[model samples]
Target: MSKHAGVVLPNKFDYGYHAEFQRQCSMCIDDATIEGIVFDFSRVEYLDSAALGMMLMWQRRAAAANKKMMIKGAKGATAQILAMANMQRIFEYI
Candidate 1:
């Protein structure tokens, strides 16, 4: 079975979510059964460059673990921001 994790992003994907984000990323990375992770951005309302940096970190971690990474439900400003950061080139959109 192909195991995957969907990490639901919070409303304010800022520095405040650092701990939680790290925990989530670690959870996924530590799980050897998890073959991929999809960052769900449907509920995110506000985000900053910090959030972008976090995403990059997650991507790197996932790569190092030999796992796939993806984005889901990124709309409005969230979508625009990801596009501006060229996240599409790194993460698959689901």
Candidate 2:
């Protein structure tokens, strides 16, 4: 398995996407070889508070596993929302 794993987020990231996100997160987090996980928001045009909550949960899990967390391609409204939520403190933007 690769050292780095990532999930390309969908356009509408909300509660409905939780299962899929959890599935992918398990694959990445369970892999011992993985040192980092990236959340690619390039294609995500909108995200609700639920999505933010999910990300926070995952960030805590990742840290507990000694894995780094990164956020990629966040721009426009997505970027603004994240900034307002202060997500940058926990996730490195790549």
Candidate 3:
């Protein structure tokens, strides 16, 4: 089992990288070998609707694969945005 933790910005969260991340997560889930994913929002200053959509998509994927996705270290406006969007229900907030 493996664990990955970090904040992915839109610029770095391009389709290619996102796909790769998904693939990794899928593999982990399939094998029941991955512990989980922890997304740290300490440095995330901005997030577009697309990013939010991507997160929701990922949440679904994780659920289908029987894996867990968690968000942590969010503060300030970032936390507010997530709350406003009701992302807390989609992604486990820590």
Top candidate on lDDT is 2
Q: How well does candidate 2 score on lDDT at residue 50?
A: 99
TM-score of 3: 0.70
Task: Report per-prediction Cα RMSD to one decimal.
Answer: 0.7, 1.6, 3.5
lDDT of 3 by residue, 1-94 (tens): 4565444443333354566657655555566556566666776766666667777887787777766788887777778888999988778877
Given candidate 2, what's the lDDT at residue 25?
91
Lowest summed lDDT window (length 10), candidate 1 = 53-62
Q: C-alpha displacement of 94 in model 2, angstroms?
A: 0.9
Better of 2 and 3 by lDDT: 2
TM-score of 2: 0.96
Enumerate residue pairs that collide in model 3: none
Error of 3 at 62 (Å): 0.5
User: With candidate 3 superimposed using the best TM-score fit, by how many Å does residue 61's alpha carbon deviate from the native?
Assistant: 0.6
Clashes of 3: 0
| TM-score for each predicted model, relative to the true structure | 0.96, 0.96, 0.70
